[model samples]
Target chain A: MPILQFVERDGILDLGWGHPRPGLLPVRQWQDATRAALDAYDWQALTYGHSAGPQPLVDWLAEHLGTVDALTASPGEFFVTAGASHALTLCATVLAAPGDVALVDVPTYHFALRILRDRGLRLVPVPRDDAGIDVEALGALVDRLRGDGQRIGLLYLVATFGNPTGLSVGEPRRTELVRFARAAGVTIVEDDTYRELGYEGAPPASLWSVDPGGPVVRAGSFSKTVAPGLRLGFVQAGPDVLDRLAGIGYVDSGGGLNHSVALAMATFARSGAYAEHVARVRAAYRSQRDALVDGLRAGVPGLDVPRPAGGWFLWLRLPEGMTAESLMVVAERNGVSFAGGAQFHTDPARGHDHIRLSFSLLSPAGLTDAADRLAAAIRSVAG
Target chain B: MPILQFVERDGILDLGWGHPRPGLLPVRQWQDATRAALDAYDWQALTYGHSAGPQPLVDWLAEHLGTVDALTASPGEFFVTAGASHALTLCATVLAAPGDVALVDVPTYHFALRILRDRGLRLVPVPRDDAGIDVEALGALVDRLRGDGQRIGLLYLVATFGNPTGLSVGEPRRTELVRFARAAGVTIVEDDTYRELGYEGAPPASLWSVDPGGPVVRAGSFSKTVAPGLRLGFVQAGPDVLDRLAGIGYVDSGGGLNHSVALAMATFARSGAYAEHVARVRAAYRSQRDALVDGLRAGVPGLDVPRPAGGWFLWLRLPEGMTAESLMVVAERNGVSFAGGAQFHTDPARGHDHIRLSFSLLSPAGLTDAADRLAAAIRSVAG
Candidate 1:
């Protein structure tokens, strides 16, 4: 067995990690995929691949995404990357120059904040509502930054089934933002990682698909839908944006990132296994979400829990004046851990009353137990 | 088959492409390695890994590199990467700032030049002789550059069985350069990609090993010794330098680059498959080198051909006044292709008379035929 990725304590449930439960991973399917890939291998499959990625994987992704988005996806619009994070790095380091302002959703993925900051890009928070990023506020913020002589390099959002909040932007709002971004010469980078995880009805039109060929560049991944270990993701953008990504120092040096895996994934994807897998995964996560919500409501009074239609997280608003920080101590004592909301915000004060729990890491019964433990922690902390 | 990485001509012997031939690529071994990795995997192996890499692979690499270099390689000194090129990109974009001057060997690997240049670093050519990079000249060059108010961010060298020239820096020179770089406060980024494919004997001591725990940062890869498609490699440096690499934006977001492949490679190395494979590869390459050298000597009169002790490529010089540009016209007609040396230089004029022919991509007999065609091309061009 490999070393554990995170620290674990006996008798404690980790609701903090926003990843799939061990049983959800297609270990057997992966072994089958590898054997198939090897059986159909060519020598060139093991050589330096096209800088855009292996064409077979790119074409496969294009077809799959096209069907999901309900549009004609062109192969030219794709560039395979190691994963969504690496694609963000391309945006942070390549599309945006250092010190440029990155307009981001208020309570974004905590790690994505680190990615932008580490690359020397300044993160300027844009407030969000139930429908997702407030377009008017984002426009004003962009204008304000630009007026202060700061160049707006990119506008990043987790548009559909977003992390930390589990929110999706409304359909009309998506179109408006794309139009505004293109007119303002601001590139919109959609972290479309959780788009396919919708347990309810279909997701809204993707920002990239809303216009098909605009500044709304996207980084999609098989991490949530398939598996993270593949380290395989792709960029959906116009030819100009992809050319710039491929022309970077490292991409040129290595013909393509993760060429062998790309070929292997292509085989897995082509065989209809990937689609079947994600369907089962979505159903499993939906039931887990329901169990957690039910337990939390019955056990913790006056707590506000916004049920997510899809994806992994449950963004909860604690009772009046109950900060995530204070509850974290009691939660740990009660043997449940969760990510505090303050770290997800650029200005910590904005998220002090929130806590984010993920249902993806446990079964329905396990999540219900975790919810009870967390509910007890909250009662103790709030009392 | 997937889309071809390079354009293939119907009748041409492609001596210009420098990579392992189909016969040498170890397809079956990779299949075994993947299967072994799957059998031994924990779910965490498919999760986001530790940013430095999976510790299992890190420890395995330390032991393997330690034995190869005859030094006690510490796990503290390693950070896993995609490959050497990706390693260079990390150095170019992360370690060094955009405007920093990069001092590189003249007639170095051509693509490496593109990697440096693409990342916005200015390349200052450092002259070389049969002994490798001229230390005295480099010292003077550094003084000249610093005097001109340029900050020297890096000095990159392929110190072992270097590309194009196929010549290693002499042992004493390696020590001197390491000492000089540390004293000068210049970080030496060693591209140690070709260190393992030595033919005649154990190659010279590595520069990183010459002065362990110094300012030297090395990027070693399985691309040359194993397969380019693995996209697995590691970085060796002091903690300070490693901390800097792991702290970068993309790395922080992704956990580690190519985590799954690293695990597979760990299994391959621990099984003694890697070392035994390299031994066989070295033997095969040694004979291929001999075949090309013998053919060129017999067919091309009055030409300068330096016999390489290890690695790929044979550096050839025209008798006089004939440019690599002139020879390319006739060589194409004779059904052979080579990389003109001019592209490998900061100043194209300096390498106009040199030509690089690779032996890694063909059989000994095929390489001999290619050399004969090249020789005829050279003779015809000169006349």
Candidate 2:
């Protein structure tokens, strides 16, 4: 009756989606955090919490995450959410409306696209370069759209380690883009969900840091670092902007985020375990990313594998004649699974030759085997 | 700026809202649950769970909650959400659309009204009697609205302890309402957030249990029974309907509900401690409710307070010549805070003479103090 149930019965590797790997989940850590929260807070932990977040966690996150990037906000600016996805959805609700146009990257995070669509907004897809969303093109597009009599609603960009592509928009683009958006009377929703697992050097200044007039809203999550199951994320924006989002949240969940998750995140942030935990994650994923790239390159000579800088994926352009759907069938038959390219595309059918492989879920040994199987599947399909 | 920060700084007691008192949260139980979850499961908990929910929580809730009302659901039929509010929002998204008319009772929850407005739906506010939403009037309204060429959207109702009203629609009306909805080809979003806080005898038969094939989606929350801070709730609907909502959830939050929250809810459900805990909550709220009613009735003799059947609220209809807003100022000056009833209505000005007092946050002593303060405020305002 509903669309959610229909296609779900068919099993997919789910690499098409972004969720924390089981191995990366700090189960004991989260439990310890939650238990500590419960024991310390009593029934109060279960009742309700501050609309922004529980104080300790927000304070700790503000302090700890500051060392990772330039944060324009103190703890007071952060509002916790059910997850990053929920945070984005709230942003969509507060910022976008029917007939309004939001500038989004082409082949963007599908969920973000869905958020805009669900909010009844017109999504203007801006072309992106390898470094990240192409600023020149974005400027031109905004100008062209305006020239064509369109009113740009807002600008949404994932600056660091974006989903599906794992490409970070460079420092120059982040600054210039925010500036352009400010000039164009657009607010920027900067999503930094994957900024923490930095296999690369330090991240550039955040958009929030550069914009002082309250045009930038930054949302960060603990999902990629300590554990995704915790489902804790926070949005930092101008107080006035945040208040509107909070009003929507007050309506949405009475509160958007769970207090226990906040407590656990606080514990993790306070203990400074997130840093060490995320470091280990980066190393583990680095090995996996390398292995995946090497395996694809060696096993499938014609494939083009873009080695992700920090995240857990290797986006591969399949060999000529090999469709992701066909390869998926072959892989499934061979007892190995990875996401088909189509799942990531706004238009699923057009990206049949692309595949997303996650080293995050596979062991070193499993990676070798999976790569071999995947290569065989591709070869069979291509041949 | 993030939305909540401004609201937090405004120094508003925010009693106009439904955020549970943080002091009542069940932190220890959640911590224990999370800790156990950590030791027992790994990536399974971290990665994407089933769209409906973690199987254990769903199964446990199905068994435990079934005693309250029979639920005809397979695993695929249940969908977890951030909270009851999220469930209702999804119902609005999937079932109602722009140009559609959602039939609501007058003096309904304001946020639901906002959601309907946000979705561009026409709201048909049917008048209500003290007994609850007038079923006969609802049927006529449905016919009248449908006759006027409006597509009847979903029937959004809160049956077990309604918000603001603190009234439960009687059983006969509940059954008749379901049948009426079925005949009209309309779906019903049954919110039971306060079901566990019943101060009276057996509650009405939930639409989900009474009419299996009718378009009824049952939403239940752990916020009232256990703690609001966990932000755990679920929707029980037909498999197909649940699936469609889940599909939107995939875009909303990779997964709808937080895994840790789900785990906490599961532990709370399976521990056999839930019933006792809920009974304790009910007993505590019932005492507070009685105190609130007594105070309002005696302290402000001319005020009309329909004895609430359950829930933590006492809605007071001010004596003639007094307005809720003006009285609220006096109450605050006297150090007692309550939400002016106007805030709960789509048209706040129309409810200027009504007030909503939450009894859950006040202890026996506090309730007395509040009552005295309220009495003085009403006297001053009336004079």
Model 2 Cα lDDT, one tens digit per residue, B61-131? 66666567655355556778777877777778888877898877667666677777666778777667766
True contacts preserved, each candidate? 0.52, 0.44
Q: Against the true structure, whose TM-score is highest?
A: 1
- For model 1, the docking class works out as medium
Which parts of model 2 have CA positions greater than 4 angstroms off?
A1-18, A70-72, A204-215, A249-253, A301-303, A347-349, A380-383, B1-24, B70-76, B249-253, B297-305, B379-383
Give each prediction's DockQ, rounded to 2 decimals.
0.55, 0.42
| Residues B313-355, model 1: lDDT tens digits | 8888776899888888889999999888888788966888888
lDDT of each: 0.83, 0.70
Q: Alpha-carbon error at B220 in model 1, in Å?
A: 0.5
- Which stretches in model 1 have alpha-carbon errors above 4 Å? A1-4, B147-149
